[model samples]
Target: MNDPKLTPQALWHCALGLLSRRDHSRLELSQKLRQRQFDVELIEQALDKLEQQQWLSDHRFAVVQVRQHIFKKHGPLRIRMELKRKGVNEAYIEQALAEEDPDWFELALVCYQSRFRNRDIPDIKEKAKRMRYLQSRGFNSDQIRYALEAEQD
Candidate 1:
């Protein structure tokens, strides 16, 4: 079997196709290109071109990712970890999170309510389980407390 030849144009096209589908951090895009067996130099050149044209940006990617994860009911902690995994810089991640300005307590409450709409007030064991669930969803202790206390309000 013959391996396909990778060209600069081909790399650019592939990057563009991925970007068209969703915002990708620079590192994510590079990893995808590398996985497809593209040359390092070609991938760099194509990414640079995309950056120059403003078609690719880690800041934009981080912002979009934060919003998407928030919509999915993930807390800022989880979102920040995800962004870090995607290779976004700390500054961009902080900027994006700050700009979004999500009310963590309110968001946690909504997420908790939606997840346990039909369940009765949790007993001690059940409360522990629910607390673990919310924590895994990236909420802090205070946010989780606020969410679990909704019944008392």
Candidate 2:
């Protein structure tokens, strides 16, 4: 599918078509164009125009990704890492998370309850396991502590 004759207009339309499906970080769009064997210079030119037109923004992408991850019950750490992997700016990621202002402890509790639903953690080993589970899901130690204690109380 490599077409050496592909032009800038063609690349622009292709990029826009991809974005119409969903928001994409600049890096993600670039990689997709690269996969299609589009000329790197043409891809960059299209991206610059899109960004200039405010049609492709890392900020918007970060916000959308954050909301989606939150809906899936993921914690901030995981979401942040994923956005960073997608090449979103750290400032934008932080801004998006701040704007959401989610209750991390509550989310952690919900996540834990979904898995263990009122089941008492009978021993240190089991409690540690639950804490570790929440941590793996991206909740911080503080939030995990609150979830464990809040449920047992």
Candidate 3:
């Protein structure tokens, strides 16, 4: 190899250092190792070892991500898209969502309220604009409807 950092020990050292900072998905670790010019085979071995040792888990990553998004009041739809982009498994995503989010309607209302606090429902144009904004935030039509209805109270 052109660089001593390309060695298997060096690769493991680098991977462990990355993991010590925080959890990462397999794909994320692979991408980071590739960026550092580590051998693909070595990267695979490192990932496999990490998984066997329970250091890297898509499940754990998905759970933390879901909790963070829920705390931020982001809708499930947006969270799903983001986790999918990170290559998380669909099953894990669903599991995480089920464990973390109890009601999308409540989350949608919080998100809407945070953005449009104390503002009346206004005219048709403003209502439509609000609808579109919630949609962009990953709320389904039903959740948006419930949120808007609750706001009218």
- TM-score of every prediction relative to native: 0.93, 0.92, 0.93
The prediction achieving the highest TM-score against the true structure is 3
Per-residue accuracy of model 2 over 17-36 as CA lDDT, tens digit each: 99999999999999999887
lDDT of candidates 1 onward, in order: 0.90, 0.91, 0.90
Off by over 4 Å in 3: none
Segments in model 1 whose C-alpha atoms lie over 4 Å from true places: 1-4
Error of 1 at 153 (Å): 3.0
**Top lDDT hit:** 2
Order candidates by lDDT, high to low. Answer: 2, 1, 3
Segments in model 2 whose C-alpha atoms lie over 4 Å from true places: 1-5
Candidate 2, TM-score vs. the true structure? 0.92
State the displacement of the C-alpha of residue 97, model 2, in Å, after optimal TM-score superposition.
0.8
Q: Is candidate 1 or candidate 3 better by TM-score?
A: 3
